[model samples]
Target chain A: MRNSFKKVYLLISVLMVVMLAACSEDETNATSEKSGGPVSAKIGVISYMTGPGAAYGEAITNGFNLALDEINEKGDVKIELIIEDSAGKQDQALTVAQKLMSSDDIVALLGPTLSTEMNVVGPEADINGIPIMGTSTTAAGIPQIGEYVFRNSIPESLAIPAALEKAVNKYGAKKVAILYGNDDLFTQSGFDTMKAEAENMGLEILTIETFQKGQSDYNAQLTKIKDLQPDLILASALYNEGAVIMDQARKMGIDLPFVGGNGFNSPQVIEIAGEASEGLIVATPWFGEKDDPKVQDFVKKYETEYGHKPDQFAAQAYDALYIMAEGLKNAGVADRDALRDALAEIKDLDGILGKFSFDEDGDVIMEPTVLIIKDGAFQQFE
Target chain B: MLGDIINPYHLQIISFILINIILGISIYITLSSGQLSLGNAGFMGIGAYTSALLTINFDLPIFLGIILGAVVAGVFGILIGIPALRLSGVYLAIATLGFGEVIRVIFVNWESITQGSIGLSGIPHLGRELFKTFKLTGFDPDMLGLKNNQFIYLLVVLILLLVNILLVWFFIRQNKSRVGRAFAAIKMDEKAAESMGINITYYKVLSFTQGAILAGFAGALYAHVMAYISPADFAYHRAIDILIFSIFGGSELIWGAIFGATFMTILPEALRFISDYRYMIYGVILIAMMAFRPQGIIDVSLLKWFKKKLKLKRGGSLGIGTKKYN
Candidate 1:
């Protein structure tokens, strides 16, 4: 029985190796082929196509493809895109980044969705001298990873302070409680900014609590916060946990106004929390409700393509693709260095997210919009 | 010739595989002694954080930092092993898993030291300063001027080769020594081994400590290679991955651990063409492998077949043969 099992195992191993080699070869061939016109450039698109962040990945890819299709149709620049899925893993992101960098033909790279994954791949891209633009990575020190790394997404540092000032002024919140996921770098950084801003605003912090990422139960922390009876609650959490925390906080009868960080900007928070999400205010760079033509066109196209309204993540990604195309057009992708130089020189570029520009550190400098969830929709907070 | 096959991309992947192989062997050591440890990643975290801090803060050389990290991890292993190895089966796995969580939490909450959730970045890569110093002294270090990734690749490969040789020698010596018999005796039948006057606790703790030291060493190398690490890198998922590598490769044999680590590490990258569905396919393959061959991808029969093909001595003892030591 063992001998037969060994034979089967060996056969399986050999079969897998052959399959892998064949598949990689096929991929290389597919990527190399260009239709009709000369392929002026090749760009790599990476995102979390699978795992918990699949929604964000899908939106980014959809936005990117929309832009790519438009550019290709116009025949101004024939840029071939090779998309790779990170599967929401750092190691996988590293592997994909390495693969993209070594291909020699890829002039620039984009996406990887999360900040943590970018932290893994950003340095490599910098070292290899390939410019990588992140669409949704908002954590601090990301652009500081190296010269080649850039992000269109505004960090929490810029967004949270504006939102906090609006919340404190509008609600007259005297005492506030802060809660955040301790494990995630994004949420933690959001919390740090919120705490600093709260102190700056002179809002008395009644209590500070933290929960692990992906943990559903926040009742224990909520119960403690309820007893503290803070006039307002500040939370730094992703959409899923933000929804749960809001729903549970309301259920626990802590009906104070909730001010959230950048993570709460997603419409899914409202969908998950239902009525509880009402009166919840958040600061974001992209507000889909904007009546601007460019914003409306992108949003309409995205809604038509994906059958869902484009959230902030999708909007930023849409702008990011346009920014990359503009860089490619200006630089005329003869070499990676020229493209890198072009990307660095991008300034005052108008897109869905207003006039987008990169600072010295490759971070986006943009005005943040404060919005409150009212009757299951985002409204400009007055 | 080897350089043609290994581009910078392949080099990074291969280096990670080497690190995982070291982790696999670490877990395999405990598995051989009939212990299932799910806390090796904790030791890895300790080693990574220690060495990274040492190099960044104390200006210690990378080699010395790695050694210190390994030593610290070995000491921590003994600390956890004493009480942790007392449990058996699923309970031991759970305990070790809890230990890993605790360590991760410490790394996260101990903000002043670990830099909180932001993680330590800009860790000096191996030989960056050495190459710079050589240039300053007017010595053309062109031959030694490997990029960080390339240098790390070579360093990890050398360490892997050295570790493999040491492990092989140790295993061979262990097989011939009385201590090895005690470990085997305990694994087969604890009550019988106890009656035969074998000190089970001492051997178990010793093996667990050794495994931790190996994991720590791997972690130090990983930190230097990647030039960045966070508590997230050493979370429970990593511990589980190490376990999977050991089990899938067949933990009974040393080569099984090495093969499993290499194959599994490369499998995801190989399945990259499938994109989002790749992980699903990977899950199916794992489930199928476990269902079909619970003993793992490598077994005694396969090893014997290789030996036969090579026309090696048939009478000599093999590290993973079915033949009982006694």
Candidate 2:
């Protein structure tokens, strides 16, 4: 029965291969015939819609959809948004980008939230001549790929130095210790930038430590930093690791204050770390509760729909789509080249996050703001 | 039926199914021999990186690079397999896992060669040439140009199907020969088989090498199709997923790998419709399937019913009754 089962299984395998080949040949025959007039231009947005990093992805989507909805309502030009889930995998990102680029209707692409995915899809974008503007890829070398690729979010190089400068000048902390996540590109890049800036500013670098992403224990690294007895601990990590380390640091009776990059912006970090997150300092381009009129409108609409405030990711993505929409309208040509030119020409556009313009390499030029967590409330530094 | 067959999305899906078919068949060799290996992902990584580097850096012909990639992966498999021949089952699985992890770490840390975690870019499109006809054929390149996605999908499906057919024929021929008896005896009891004068290590190493060759072939195809790859693409999680799929699809069957790959690839897409609840739903579904049908969905137990259903649809009740009896 087992041998028969194995033979039958092999037969089925043979059948499946035949069936798939037939399916492909059929598609090839179909591809030989085609033509269509452009209707409403559809823009395919590929992002990590669901995964370990789903929350951040969801935020980017929320911001993007908000912009799309507003633009469509105005009816200046008909634009449709088609979304594909990257699932935070490199292969999926490239596949989704290729599918989008192949379609004539899709004028632009909006995401692939992480820098790792950017590496996969960037080549496709450059080759296919599709404009792909990212929401939150802060990798140092992303913009150098091509003219078609643009990012509305400020790079970590710009954001980290401002945060470090704040820690040195405002908090008057001379001795600083650093703990960062090595696996994540954003965290690693932020840590490298902060380290370089700290050395340049003449701050005493007491200790440098690293941990992997999705880690729950940081007792060893935190204890090592505590022994250094630095005035401030700068942690560069996502919410999961940052929360665990902060909670453990408090339990270990380390009273030293903590400062972090954008990874600390999640409210879930507070919910997870509890009292440990109090007096935690972080920096980001967008704050959900900021009183700025543009930010206020975005926060109000987002809360009304999702029953929560927008995070920096959501704000950046929302701003990204709006920027792309504005570029599309300005370019007036729905094809790739015109959109690329229009995006490159963007200057002083006030977004929910900040007033931004693409630099020569298609990176957003914006100042980073520092925020303080006091009694579980995020407050912009005075 | 026509619409379903001709849809580019479905073609892409089938291409992946074919790739999975190749990997699954290769894995069947090891599974039938009662040896578990987790290092197939390593072979795949080597194949992908090798083919990608050849096509991008060396400007070699795509077909030649793909074959070379498989050869390179096969060589690495043999190299790794010889040292790992002493291990079995769980120990073998652990060794293979360690091997895969070491390769991934090296690919990430060795920036000078691999471009680090940033990954190599500007990989030339291999599939595009499949649609392009030479001037002798009187084909215009502009009008005949295939979208990279379509070309890759078709290319992958064609190559994988051809390789799979060849493998099936080879295995079938081997089954009737002395080699087949040797492999079966070794599978039954390695020590007993060894006492009977069969070289246990040779067959074991052969299984690992063959499996690695398929994995490498699949990886090479994937690199060209996607035009980019990173260390994370071949992470331990992916290795585990492939193994889980193999078991879930019934490792004993050559087609189970395809079943598992197709299931996993489309399963996530189907789960995507459920949005946030997809992962939770996936775990529950996997548990339920395993509990009810551990032999897999395509086992003999279901084959009888499936064949009957096919006959019923083809010629109605009259033919279906006769088919069922047969």
Off by over 4 Å in 1: A1-6, A19-39, B1-5, B127-165, B172-176, B312-326
A1-382 per-residue lDDT for model 1 (tens digits): 5577557857977967775574356324444333544336788888999887798898888888888888788876777788999888777788788878877678889988988889888987887899999999998889998999999998998998888888888878899999999888889999989998889888899999999888989999999999988888999998888999999988888788788888878888888999998978888888888988888888888888889888787778778878888887788643688888888999999988889899999998888889999988999998
Per-residue lDDT for B1-326 in model 2, tens only? 32222334555555666666666666667776778888878888998999999988888988888889899999998999999978888999999999998888888667678876656666765555554533347644334355444544565567667876787788767755777677778888988999999887888888788889878888888787766777778888867776777787877555566577777665655444455676786688689868866877655455665666566676674554454445
**How far does residue A215 in candidate 2 sit from its true spot (Å)?**
2.7
TM-score of chain A of each: 0.92, 0.89
Most accurate candidate by lDDT: 1
Q: Can you give the TM-score per candidate against the true fold?
A: 0.92, 0.82
Candidate 1 residue-wise lDDT at B61: 87
Q: True interface contacts reproduced by each model, as a fraction?
A: 0.56, 0.14
| CAPRI grade, predicted model 2 | incorrect
- TM-score of each model's chain B: 0.87, 0.84
Clashing pairs in 2: A59-A314, A63-A318
Instruction: Give the Å shift of residue B320 in candidate 2.
Output: 20
Best by TM-score: 1
Query: lDDT per prediction?
Result: 0.83, 0.75
DockQ of each: 0.52, 0.17
